[model samples]
Target: MADEAQQGQLVNDRYRLVRALGSGGMGRVWKAHDVQLDTHVAVKELLLPSGFSAPDRADLLERALREARSAARLRAHPNVVTVHDVTLVGGVPWIVMELVSGSTLQERLRVEHRLPVEEVAEVASALLRALGAAHAEGIVHRDVKPANVMLTEDGRILLADFGIALNEADDGLTGTGVVIGSMPYLSPERARGEKGGAPSDLFSLGTTLYEAVEGVSPFKRETKVGSQYAVAHASVPPPRHAGRLEPLIKGLMERDPDARLTVAGALELLAPAKPAPPPPVSPPPAFSPPAPEPPEPEPRPASAPGIRAAAAAPSESRPSTTRPAPARAASAGARIRAGGRTRRVPAPPPRRPLRGLVLFAAGAVLIAGGSYAAYQWTRTQYFVGVNDGHVAVFRGINQELGGTPLWEVETDHPEIELRYLPVYQRKQVEATITADGPDDARARAAQLALQASACAKNAGENGEDSVLTEEERLLTDRCGN
Candidate 1:
């Protein structure tokens, strides 16, 4: 069967193989042309080893057919890759599917090392939607991993390779006590040989997302058995680069299936906030004029003693004459008539001091203390940033004190040049990638070292003449590539 699969070979007298897209242990994927549909399609050819017994061969064929049926059921979903048709040639299943034009998440990770948190969330949300559709049909994608996730060139995330999916309508193919999934991403229940359902798929999705942001699988170990054990027993290492995605990843990766977040709960966490309802606009304040000052009392005219002697003698007998009080009292100086003369009232003296000096001294002390506290807080924060042209770790906030940066370089990786990084990652490093602590910052730098090495390898492969410096050669050696 392997020898029969060659370039330009016609399958079922319709689809023609153009090129081999990729291959795995069980099968190979080809970019083929569908004659009737007049379009390019990906064909999965199941290639069983000659050493396999009849039962193993039957199991492999059944799994391939199931993969086609599972994907065909969710053809309407935008996130799930559409399966076109399934046919058997020479007694082996050849599954035809839509040709997604882009790299896998695994390939992208190999180049970029890790993605930004927001981008990881976007990828996770798309995969969740796909899983939601699959779960609706009682199908579980048991083999979810970075390699099975397709990031199309046209801004779409598609989940592919449902070869190991569990369909409720179909009878179980694998024997009891046999686990069928990637070791690092296998759910604890599945690791314990349990028939996992929706929760198991969610756990794999969580592990994939975790790797996307952290550049390493949480449960992956040195060996397959060790990783399987870690998946079932080890606690998830805390994510330092996941920022806002930490809670969602943690919830989805919960060890207990019952305690893990449901599809609805995960979606709710990813949904954007409702813009806070625009803050409830308040009406403009009404206008009210201040009260006018009361008018001053009018001066009285003096009367001639001889012309109005009776009136003058009676008013003078009381020793003084007084005018009738006005309705509103004068707020300013008041005039008084005494001894037949008018005089203005004197103003009151200023009030005594209220310990203003003491209060001002206390305020100055508070301001100084606050400034010191802020400086101390900056010392605790750490970030991964670019120092000159290389990756470096800094201890302090990714901010500036006046015009000078508040951060200081804690460690410098001169071997990892910034120009070797992808443009997006270069921007992130320039802006700074926040870390939980000094150790986390160093770990982030180590990841960047790997990214730089990959970039250098790519450059060399593409004949770009990007000669690596002595330090860069040492970096590549350290990365074991």
Candidate 2:
């Protein structure tokens, strides 16, 4: 430990490097003391090898500055490391952050291999909440592996790195055509060279949570190549150790990014709100009308001479032109009671409101069917396209007349000059839109590409930076040949 202390020289004149915290491909980090402030801090310094040119060095320095600014903006959430100051020491950028005393998630996993279900849930819940906050700010932590997460003594999870984080509407200071991030946590679209978006971060978090619960990442591989392949094609198997949380864990880890849960959706799943009760159903209305009872026939009494003459006046003269009324025979009881008794039948009861009830039922059925059809269409609609040189997504376009474009993003690919088709395919519209400058058009095109790629790949909306990559260069060069 004493010899290790000798390795790092004091930084920024005020921070005295005491001991090494950790070392990595980027540089070495140390636990240091701020003599002026009389506080403990962690100082990270870059140590890029000698072969790099001066311009490359400058770019690296700029990246470091950007990273510092990003980390400072994160503030001091319980799950985040606080950035204090940034400076140049020994010609390399150095950052001072709060000294957190805890083991990294990677170290813990290395020793214990797997966390218990309860413990995993506790840790995951906190991490996810922190992620939700970051995502709301349009920040995507490109690297979300175990190594970057620190578990403090009080059992708090702290996300440690913002080196490769991409802020929404970035200024492109990180430059074009550069890919930086780990592979295991990469979503399929990202593995296929898509930008890592909010969904991508969720994918990484899913990987982390999967490891926390299952004792292994579902995409574990001995080599980066193998891991990339698994990420792209492997069907995420059901967790061997998952107990009751199996469905959630598997769902979060779905290869189709669209199928995976969003931050809001995931929160609801893990800590569900109170469910609403179903409404009461009314009984059907009675439809049939009541029947009337049968009525008895009645007989006429003898008429007076004057009344009979008046009744027969019109017919008496001509009467006899039609036919004389015939006398009907009757039984003794009927003749006796016929003159005194008369029976009447009650009019049929008014028709019940059966037609209205039938119409209402039919309307309800139509509503339910329409809703289901819309839902199915939404599930089927997917948007995939190139953005910022890589594939990006604009999810759930099928249910919508014009789907919600997740966001407008820049594409990473170089411009393709199409000559003849512009005239044939309505170039006038394109020309009018281009008044905003080619850059904006490119940005829109990139956004469209992302949406297209998302649909084609069935990925989610959290897209990566549309920076170019070594692989894309190789593939393009090879394909062009």
Candidate 3:
């Protein structure tokens, strides 16, 4: 015990780690052994990463501890993953959960693209069972999403990660005013800053089912405002492949939480129905229109009035359309005007071709960006690195080839660890910038850390810049020693 404690040690005098299961913006999750209990268990090491207000860190830690308590209260449910224990070691919370083996719905989506409606019905049943259990126990799994679901090897779906659960027994964990749930799956009531409940979980389940069959979120859009608007005001676009299950999906996703389908009602909806859905058409890429829809005006009709009017005339082929405009006067006059006279000008080289070409080039870029961003926003949640004038934490992973800034915080901590901050996304304000680029310290730290990781990968162990060695120094404050 003495030797083991000296070398990594057992957590809470019981669990000994065997191997890391995975790591994300949250700290590492490990497959571990419970020596005292004589069983295998899963352990999560939660960090208080640098960069959060003291109050938020405190609330976050308390809420995380509540995760164990909340899930444990629902241990009787087969679909709810069991929580065994939680321990505080060095200000980090170690969560001991049931050892379930299999892939996540998130990972499955990455491979299968979209699942059959039959399979999605099964998923919905599993999720509703878990939510029903939690709800019965007065616990709300506030952060439900595809990523939070675990599909076991033996064909069972388990609900995991209740870290931000709302426990009716205690409302203390909330009230920090931080919205901590994935935006795409966020219930409209919650998305609009209203209180959420069992109905909200059902709404999220509808989204997960939608994503499973449609391969896209019902309310997904390029920007936060657009997405929130979709969630709040815009109707969910019909799921082309949902077939008979469409009614249930829509019922669960009602904007008014009180009116959404109940867990019990959904169970009835999950019964195998008559007439299977037609074979799915290949899903369009994220940025592309789902089907041939009404065309957008070239150069984005919403923004450029001049370009829309200039481009509209020739396409409409109606001179009457031109007669109506102060919008078109300048472009027409510019094309035929003379300094002294309204003399005829040899049909000035057609400006439409040039305008169309430039518009296409510009529109192509935004469309491409929108597509990539939509995919990443809905399918893959982001990781944020904490930046305090102190040691750099695991900043490397945050620097992916193309990632979006989904959230931010104002903190004074030397370092803070948040297992899941991306879930609490604030709207993007892209207009502000400094000459140095991205006033976001996390962005800068991530870029620099990746540079360091790349250097180590190419130069080997003895390299001046090594991710592993520098990480140790940052954590230990032994830099330059």
Best by TM-score: 1
Could you tell me every candidate's TM-score relative to the true structure?
A: 0.65, 0.52, 0.52
The C-alpha stretches of model 2 lying farther than 4 A from their native spots are 1-8, 46-57, 169-178, 272-481
Candidate 1 to native Cα RMSD, angstroms:
8.7
Q: Model 3, 150-184: lDDT tens per residue?
A: 88766778998775676654332245554656677
| Best-to-worst TM-score order | 1, 3, 2
Q: Which candidate tops lDDT? A: 1
Better of 1 and 3 by lDDT: 1
* Backbone clash pairs in model 1 (N, Cα, C under 3 Å; residues 3+ apart or in different chains), count: 0
The segments of candidate 3 whose C-alpha lies over 4 angstroms from its true place after superposition are 1-9, 24-27, 37-39, 47-52, 169-176, 220-229, 273-481
10 residues in a row with least lDDT, candidate 1: 472-481
Ranking by lDDT: 1, 3, 2
